[model samples]
Each structure stands twice: as C-alpha cells, then as structure tokens.
Target: MTTDMKQVYAYPDALTEVEMRYCPGCTHGTAHRLVAEVIDELGIKDRTVTLATVGCSVYAYEYFDTDAVQCSHGRAPAVATGIKRVQPDTIVFAYQGDGDLASIGMAEIVHAAARGENFTVIFLNNAVYGMTQGQMAPTTLLGQKTTTSPRGRTAPEAGFPIRVCELLDTLDGPAFLAREALSTPPHVRNAKRAIKRAFETQVAGLGFSLVELLSTCPTWWGMTPLEAIKHVDEQMTKCYPIAVFRDRLAAQEGEQSAESAPGEGE
Candidate 1:
C-alpha cells in the first residue's frame, strides 16, 4: 500500500491515567503518544515489555500501560536483552534519552546493536539533558548553550553531537534502523511509521531495531512548544537527517525472490 493510504487511530486503551509532568513545549508527550499508539496498533499491548531508562523519561513506566520496568542510568538495552531472552515471545522495547543512550549507556547500546538482539529501542534525543538540570548531552548541537555549557558548546571542549543513526548503522547486527522527529504533523506521521516499523521488525523475529527521535525540551531550551518544534526543524534536522539506515530483513526477502526467479527459457 502507498504511504499516504496508511491510517492511524487514537489508542483508547493505551492512554495514560495520570497527568503528564513534562514541561510546556516538551515533545516527550508527543513521543509517548506515538509509542502508545504503536503498541495499540500492533496489538502487542499485553505481550509487550517496556523498559524506562533514567533521565527525563524515567516516568515512562508510569505513563505506558504495558508491563514496564525501570532501569539504571543507560541500562535499558541490557535489561531488554535479558527480558527478551527469557521470554522470547514477548515484545520488548527500551525507551531512553540521548544522555542515557549516547553517554552513560553507550557501551550497552553499542553491544546490543552489535549482537543484533531481538528488541526495539525508542531513542529520544532532546539535545540537552532536561532531567538533570539542563546539562549538555551527547546529542547537544554545536554552539548550543546549556547549564553546563554556559558559553555555548565549544568544539574544542565539548566535541560534536553523536549522530546515533550513523553511529549504529556502522554495526552489522541491526535488522532495521531509522531516525525521526516529533515536531510537525508530517514529522509526527513519519515518526509513527518509524516506530511501528521497528516493532514490526522485532515481531517478525528479526534482529535489533532502533528509531532515534530528535525531540524538543522546551523547559530546558527556553522556548515554547511551538518554538521548540520550529527550532528542531531549523537546527536539529540539519545535524540528524531523518531516514532509514538498514533494512536487512526486507533485503533478505528480496534476495530470496531474486534467487528463485524463473529462467529466461521457462
């Protein structure tokens, strides 16, 4: 079917019972809604096991209705590995922030991608570390000022933002990989597709799948929600291009078809 033909519905059963505590203009709420919608759409709510990593998203467990687990700073991937290994049929997913994924839990993420473990990862890259008082995160853009980088992020001292999609694409184990954003309506549509695609990959018994979402932190960034989305479109997309990196599972199917093609004589 064409991409335009796909329809998305509201997830009634997956709605959060508690009010959100995120700052105004924060895209976490949008990201959470997309994930919950994906879970409901895929019909994996009961069978799903979610891992909420430390950082601004620590309260993810409280929002998502599925069986959720809270892990230490940046340990969601490791926890997901254990859960999926023990319960192979369960749909396992890890929701983590850039600080948790690219900084403290870098080792875990790299190894998980390298091992091609069967799980889905929803990585939220909000530039600065929102939960820890606006510190510079691994995905903070150049010249972006944070509480830690008061004079803007200097290349000589802070280094460049790690492009998670490009970093993980170099690894051989991931069956599917993509980068997305939750800024605008079109972006939200793409983000939903990317997220669902990741889960669908795991459900098919393929290897690891990850969709890194370039999100917004209005409170930390000192902007309104609308401004934050505008900023992400203007600044963030330049650093992290939204696109698919790998589709090994799909490629393998194509290869099999090519090999089984009829001979010219037949």
Candidate 2:
C-alpha cells in the first residue's frame, strides 16, 4: 500500500451514492456536484431542501442527499417559494433546466423574484431541451439547431435566446445573479463560487438569488463529451457572456464601507 498519496477531494456528503444516469459528458452531474458542495460547505445539509423540476434533472431528488421534492415542470420556483415561506429558516434552492425554467416556469420565477422570495435557484442552461429529444429551449442560441429546429434557430421564427441573469438583474428583488460556464476546470471552479454566493445570499436573509450555469448536453449536441464542453467554452458563451449581473450583498458591503470611511481630512 502506498502511503505517500493524499486525498485532496472527496465526494460531497450532500450528494448521494446513486449512479448518475446523464449522458456521458453532460454537465448536469458537474452542476449537481457544485450545488451539493455548496450545501455541504454552508453546513446546511440538514436544513437544505431541493426542489427538482422537470427535464433531464427530473430525477434529481434521488441524487441529492438533502430533503427534496419533485416539482412540476416550470413550477420549481412556486414550490420553493412555498417551502421557504412555511419554514423561513430552512435553506431552500430549486434545481431547474433551461426549458423547465426559462420557458414554462417563466412567470413563476419572475413573480417570485419580484416578490423578493428568500430562497436560491440553481439554473442550468444547456440551450436545448435535452431530455425531450433536444427541442429548442428558451435559452437556445440563435442559429443553434435542435430536433425541433433542424434548420437552426432563426431570429424571425424563434427570436433571440433569453439571457436569464441579465433579465433577472433588471429586477430589484434579487440579492445575487450571475452566470458561469462548466466547460473547463477554471470555469467549473468559478461556477462553484457563484453557487456559493447564491447560497450565502439566502443564508443572510437577502432576497431572491440565482446562479445560471451554462451546461453541456453531449448527446443532444451531437458531439462527444470533449466536443460538447468545447462548444460551451467557445460558441455558447458568445451568446451568453459569463459575469455577475447583480450582487446586492456586495453592493451593500460597498455602501457600508463608504459610510464608514473617514470624511474629508481625518
């Protein structure tokens, strides 16, 4: 037995031991790990509740070790809202895919954010409905082809892809809003950080918070695992720039700092 090797990483306790069934190379598992890691890091595993929505992640309730609920398509925000209100101290977060979130549940999410619901949302944007045979989703990049849009998404026919973080940033309710890609190691680390920030906002009793993760669906994209991740790193990011659109926590901290600064000649 070699005693020199040391383990730097271990499977997140918040994540279950169930075998992942996502398509090889898909980033749903990566996103799941990031969320689970945040749950673990926040020491909220006992109080965490995950609302799993329809789409590829419909069975996500089985993957997470925390208390989870199976929500109707596009209704995760509504369910999460109810949970957070009933048990304000619990850490609640919704896991949703692009179609489940940016499409059918659009109204639910918008209103929840507008009301400043004290919860978090972990949104995965793969640009297509990977579970339902790769239909064009609300976040699908223009000119990207899907089973429903075999000719590529056209501006006239499909309109432009929805940038969720940017849209939510326009609202005053959210305490945090950001987007990150899961294409490479560095980007994955950043995605985890963004997720943690969203969780932190909820822990601080701030308003709505969401982290949109640009994910990969290799099977639907007609690419190998490596190719799918590359596509996200290159093409998909062009349509949705990775950045923090809003962070009320950071803003409030900045304001506090300025207020405490010595005035004039101290």
- Provide the clash count, candidate 2: 0
Best by TM-score: 2
Clashing residue pairs, backbone N/CA/C < 3 A, model 2:
none
Specify the highest-lDDT model's number: 2
Work out the TM-score per prediction.
Answer: 0.91, 0.95
| 146: Cα error in model 1, Å | 0.3
- lDDT tens per residue, model 2, 145-235: 9999999999999898999988988888888999999999999999999999999999999889999998999999899999998999999
lDDT for each residue of candidate 1 in 122-192, tens digit (9 for 90 to 100): 99999989998999999999999999999999899989999988999999999999998888999999999
Residue 41 of model 2, lDDT score = 88
Q: CA shift at 169, candidate 1, in angstroms?
A: 0.6
